[model samples]
Target: MSLLAQLNAPFMYLLCGGIILFVALVCVFFMIRAYRAGKAMGIDTTKMKRVITASATFTLLPSIGILLGVIALSGSLGTPWPWLRLSVIGALHYETQVAEAAAEAVGLQSLSASLMTPTAFSTICLLMSVCIMWGMVFSVFFNKRYLRRLGAGSKSGKPGGGFGDRAMTAMFIGLICAYMGSYIGGFVSGNGLFRCAGSWIPLGVVAVACLSMAGFMWLYEKKNAVWVESFSIAGSMILAMAAAVGLSALA
Candidate 1:
């Protein structure tokens, strides 16, 4: 390989950044739309900022996890990069006992594929549960925004009557952000003449996240923010899947 090419082993990082940037842009668009809706509904910008920021921070991890998961699904790495696949598969299965029990708590998303086998990219859709779990906490807080807007007053940690709505809204917002962010991530995950640069994903998303939040704040004073769940469960999940793949690079 050429010296220049050698310097950029694993260009997926760039693509990741692009995907993040795109998500932020879309998020801002959605925010403006939501703001308009809020205006029509009398949603206060001051509160909008607070609520959005809170919601974003709460679920940023899951959103990123989902992105990584999607990339994994796409097999954009073609051959699983060098050690990423091995680490992933091995970790998933070795922890089978742990995973099975933990999965029951969240409806049991399939963590069957050990991250060790040949690079086929086939695995269960167990990651969704992770998304839902992280999202649940975020959802709880979101409803508070609505309640506060309705003149219910303010407080945190303690649950309020309108918590459900805020929770649901936060879930919805988280979903949208994750979905939009995926697109941004896609744009910057490779190193080829056409592939995205993975490193760029974090930067792109951060940039977009900052810009979107700023726009919402300036225009309305508001707003809201990993990989796609490691692209599985938790950083802890890395152990089991890594074993399955016969490797443990990031666990």
Candidate 2:
């Protein structure tokens, strides 16, 4: 059978649908419980409604991005696994990295329908599952202890009271720098997936995104545009994606 046929088989779609339905049910259950708890705690109904509305509004863009990731991975891993994995434990980009690493472990350059076999695909799924499971297990069993060890100030009820927040900020900055460095390296080596007009598309996308974000910030400050404050990141991301496509067309 063709890889596409296999990945998008009827059984796969059914499995994906079932898993998504289960997740939805679980979410609904928790949401109901939380609603009841809020009422029990005498939280104002109007405030709760506003909170929910704002939260959902903020989630719209990120949820769309997650859906895009699912679509992207579905082409390679199929609907069931990507849906299951992303619906559970794993960020969109992290899952893709894990999938690629899993593929590489089995001697594959990249996951393609033509190149993937059942066994290879299973291996990739298993590796990805194990990696996520390990993190989940650690978080479930030892995260609190680890935080305590880091002097997070849990006992004082003022968690991360001192340098912990600063350390975390530093760590996040370092992670961002590492990812940016990799992008730079890819640009320099001409080794990125998308190349446009003799340059990596990612670099151009990043440049466009950074400039867009700066513009948004300027508008938010100088023009005092309140609407742009909440949408700056999503706006920049969308513009970057558009820039990428435009650059690709030029190439």
Candidate 3:
């Protein structure tokens, strides 16, 4: 896990993502085969649609959540206001590690060092516990439904690129976001944006990123297209990272 502590962890994550992507394809191939067998067995297919739709639609919010920063960086990009947004998950990952560092330096039992003070710690802990519980339940629900749809039979034929239609879109968005976040992280880190340590940022940047994403969400509401899914998700990741990193830099 020490390897994970380094900012160089992106390379590791990229490698892991590639391996997982391949594994997902293999699983998907078997799923398709089983799904076809279910049809032969005359099983009802309607139940599967809910899981499929949920898989596609659930990401809609978080995608917008990540793009808040990419939009704010518009002026930095020297582009028009409505240019397509990107993501920065690779960079903002520093926060997770930073928290770990602080916790190690000072015991986790010490306190929450954020703006919340003593009371904020409990609220933050409560919120995180809630999210963890929600994710666990959601995972079980989706996994069981998906497995049921795939049927119990095995022995798959040649696998197609059966990645549920969003693989390419997600990969493209992820690769782009990795680069964008790396650049931003490097710039702020090198330039000393957050005092000597890079832990805070100007609120204006946060506001802009939020507003830009909101504007795009509005545009998205007007135009409903599948291709935009990748853009929206990647965009939100970037926006949120930028907001976070920017805040850190300024602080």
Top TM-score model = 2
Q: Write the per-residue lDDT of candidate 1 for residues 39-58, one digit (tens) a residue.
A: 88776887787666656655
TM-score for each predicted model, relative to the true structure: 0.27, 0.67, 0.27
Name the lDDT of candidate 2: 0.81
Global Cα lDDT for candidate 1? 0.45
lDDT of 3 at 188: 62
**Off by more than 4 A, model 2:** 1-14, 22-78, 90-127, 159-161, 191-198
Q: Candidate 3 lDDT (Cα, whole model)?
A: 0.47
Candidate 2 lDDT by residue in tens digits, 1-251: 78777878889878767877887899899988988889997889777776666566667767888988888888888777887788877788799888988888988889766778889998998898788787878889998989888766366755455777888899999998998877777776655344522367778888999999999999999999967766777788888888989999986
lDDT of each: 0.45, 0.81, 0.47
Identify the superior model by lDDT, candidate 1 or candidate 3.
3
Off by over 4 Å in 3: 1-26, 34-212, 223-226
Off by over 4 Å in 1: 1-10, 60-251
Give lDDT tens digits, candidate 3, residues 39-104. Answer: 777767764554455455656756564455434432222112112212211222332333334444
User: What TM-score would you give candidate 3 relative to the actual structure?
Assistant: 0.27
Q: Candidate 1 has what TM-score? A: 0.27
Candidate 1, residue 30: the lDDT equals 96
When summed lDDT is taken over every stretch of 10 residues in candidate 1, the lowest stretch is: 223-232
